[model samples]
Target: MNHEHKISNWDLIKNGLFGENTIFRMAISLCPAIAVTTSLKNGFLMGAAVLFVQTMVNITVSLLRNFINPRIRIPVFMLIISGWVSVTDMTMAAFAREAYRQMGLYIQLIVAFASILARAEMFANKNKVVPSMFDGIGMGLGFMFALVVISFFRELLGRGTIWGYEIVATKPLLIMLLPTGGFFAVGILMAFFNWIDIRFYGGKGAGGAGGH
Candidate 1:
């Protein structure tokens, strides 16, 4: 009776992985997806951090949904998410000191990313705990896919390497690793996705405009 709609776990995974890819589809978490993806390692690290934070927060929020007052849900969600991020920060500092140093403020900045909050408000708030967990994984994967691709390009042409493993022996573009390069990479990728959506997926699109 509870799962009357009968949404299977596999169905959920498919939804997140492809049907609702965070970048080319859902388009929910773009800020970090674009800003932090300077290298393959950075992109992967950021994505893993987001996955952990999102999954934990989603489950926690879903369990507390009934207790959380609607009037203060946003603030409550922010506090809970921040708690997980703090924990993650400390864990990273303990084991991966170098990554923790490299990540710096961005690691903590995950607290403010709208995507996590969006999950709490939209999916986790109403869904059961298990579904909420799946939602988080799906959304995080979508976000990761977007970030990895962008970082892949940025690290390659911008630096002539993939995640610091040198593929090209040249001096590289240099500019691709800069802030301006992030903008260029994201803009070009955005255009490419939009074109694909229009040409193939009908452009109904996800998220705000620009076809996500």
Candidate 2:
């Protein structure tokens, strides 16, 4: 059998969004996905913010990779990421004060999100600017996709709404809004995705803690 090795941008993006998703498939970054996805809107906004952060950080990190020393690469990466996040934090505070307030410390916590760091160290550190940027877009979409999935279910069942728009009318599954419920909701979804992978892909899918 002849081996074929061809990769396209679409494949990369799709892999990041679905095949290698940080939430369902990879199971990484569930904390933010679960914590902030109280509503569909909140989940969307959080995803947007993360997407912006990831793209900028990836580009910048890739640009500076050669300049950073191995001994202090992590700290340097943190500084760069935190600086960008601070800018984003301030921008949000100034323009979207309500959202800023809604996000609170979580916005600041973006600097420490392992997803961003992982991209910096793994992909951005070695890849060129364009590829790093694409990676950011892919990973960001994946992260957002996961958040939206979890939030969609949580909102519909927990509040009878989607993106604050009334969908189902009932008392609602109030537990979905609580912290414990977040875990259960996301866990069940993850298991389902895994099960699907096992059935269709022979159990060979991208396996990791999802997020480091």
C-alpha lDDT of all candidate models, in order: 0.80, 0.81
Which stretches of candidate 2 lie above 4 Å from their native place? Answer: 1-6, 203-212
Q: Candidate 2 — what's its lDDT?
A: 0.81
Q: Quote the positional error of residue 146 for candidate 2 in Å.
A: 0.5
Tell me the tens digit of each residue's lDDT in model 2 across 1-212. Answer: 01101445576577678777767766667778888988888888788888889989999998998899989999999999999899888888898887678886787888889888987898788877777788788888988888888889899889999988898788388999998879988888888877877688666544643321
Per TM-score, the best of the predicted structures is: 2
Off by over 4 Å in 1: 1-6, 26-28, 203-212
User: Candidate 1 lDDT, tens digit per residue, 23-80?
Assistant: 6665556777767888888898888888889889999999999999999999999999
Question: Which pairs of residues collide in model 1?
Answer: none
